[model samples]
Target: MRNHGLVAFVITTAVLVPAAAHYLSAGHDQVVKFATATTSTLELAGAKIEARLEHPLVDPGESLRIKLVASSAVGKRLDVGLLVYGSKGDEDDRVPSPPVGVAHKTVSIAIDAEGNGSIEIAIPLAGAVENRYSPSPFTSYEVLVMAPRAATKLDRLRRNSALIGEGEGIPEYNASASKFMNLYSWRHDLQGEDATLFGEGVVARLDAHTRTINPAIAIETPSTTEVGKVFAVAVTVKNASRKPARGLVLDVETPIGVVDGAEGIEALVMPDNATFDLDAGESRRFQFRVMPDQVGVLGLYARVTCNGDDCDDDSALTKSGTFDATEIVKAQVVDEAPSIVGRK
Candidate 1:
């Protein structure tokens, strides 16, 4: 019997080790890679703008930034206007408001054979400065590089540009930018959990909410319980996104009626965009209590919010489903009699 138990244990461990290793390896491959690109004649302001953008990357706060250099492709002198729009379609208009915490300054440059340029402009992340903007999982913006054609000589005002690293005569000017833009469209799964303490005693703890592109709940029980007993519950949240998520909110609901002090405590607060940040490949735990008042089946639900405002309003944001709580029965009897003193 002992040998059979040992063999079973070894077999379980062997099966789980490879599974765990495979998951870890898959996670490692999901890290982001930063690259650069250049472009010429970027259409802007009803005209083509001659310029190049360098070292563009999706920033930590979920915004994009790049170094820009502009000049006239034509040898003739002309005025240049550059604008950054948040859409890919024809309504190419400047962002209604620059993302919060970003500083931007537009400068005029002379177009010479060598491509005269000015200092790089830095645009900060939107909605961060005033706490007004909500985090968005799918957002895009376009940089319009525009140069006016010479009034007398239409052919003299050229707006040719290329990504910085690509060598001269690279057939496609905007190929690198196009490729990077494609990457922006890819989405990833995210999952997380958190706990909060509420009601009379500090014994109550709520679980952290998990956020993922897919709506699902995974719960793990660490220990067993009896009926009518109060115990601690720990919840873990996982971020399964290919990219990081900001401003996360999680809520858990218990189906059982309040025992003594377990009422009106349904939500767990996570680090908001204003608070602690959860990076990709990260997980957090929340602890609370499960106090059973009677012996019956119990149900628990967990809802998650990520990268958006009004987490409770599904119309404006995304949410996950409920996680069912484990059921346990109450003790049959209680010992009430006292024992004799010193009677062993």
Candidate 2:
């Protein structure tokens, strides 16, 4: 949970552990990546803003569309500037630099007097994919969005040149009179006490996973139920690829209330290291027994992973080909159960 004022980067790469009550609000190339859809919200200066994706997964050649919505307490049209940069790097490695493809994009956002406005941008990810020779080339097309000190230098940037469209190589300046749009340096500059005075920008990231094949995950649960009553959650995983996949695992998570531990929350059904093999077109189903303690909406998250392998003969030097699929379902917990909740 890294936050620079109001930036949210929810990395959906699932950890192969027995998670209790982990909630999820829910990508790719040959060595293409895919990412689950997500949303981030934060406050910039006195403005409330959010960035979100409508689709759950995206791949190469597809357009990554993001919707930016913002509202402020101010009583006038507010103008702000933002930067979009993309790069290719290892999924595990940090330090993203050398902006890929068309350098980056600079745009201006205007919030009306009502302080409500939205902007949508679609970027083609063809240039963001990295071709690798490694047996299991784990690479990520990292797309970063930075909105710096909204409305400060937007007029100047627009006056210099049309900063809304794409650009070529990394240019030092947008126009002859325009200063540089260095998001990396601008972020450090805003870390001072005067950051709030000039307003702050948000940084959002999207990643792609490289794999030979992947699995499809699905979960089924009731819509409404009563507190302290048991309900069953069924999870299905299918290998839709033509090749066989090993190291297959599935995990289900429920809410572990404010209490100390997992005393009477949900029963432990699936083991942590419960790995199996699924041949081509094979599918498996698992059921989890759940009981809600308090009354409210309970979020159920399930993730399935396949080591969709490309490794050595003995599989000693394993090529890490990990494709994680996740799904989220919500069950309403009321004082009384519906007719459907009485079954099983």
Q: Pick the candidate with the highest lDDT.
A: 2
Q: Residue by residue across 1-344, what tens digits does model 1's lDDT show?
A: 01111111111110111112211111111111212244444432322344544423233244344444444334434344334433222122221222111222344445567644443555533322211233222233444433322111111111122344334443332543443322222223212210111111111111111112222333333233565465444444566544455676544445332122322212111211112235666565544444544444344444456554422333222343333334445576778899768956
Q: Any runs in candidate 1 off by more than 4 Å, and if so which?
A: 1-217, 222-224, 256-276, 307-318, 332-344
Clash number for each model: 39, 10
Q: Determine the C-alpha RMSD for candidate 1 after optimal superposition of all C-alphas.
A: 24.6
Backbone clash total, candidate 1: 39
> Measured by TM-score, how close is model 1 to the native structure?
0.28
Model 1: ten consecutive residues of lowest lDDT: 193-202
lDDT of 2 by residue, 157-213 (tens): 433543322344433334512332343334556544335423244555444322222
- What does the lDDT come to for candidate 2? 0.44
lDDT of each: 0.33, 0.44
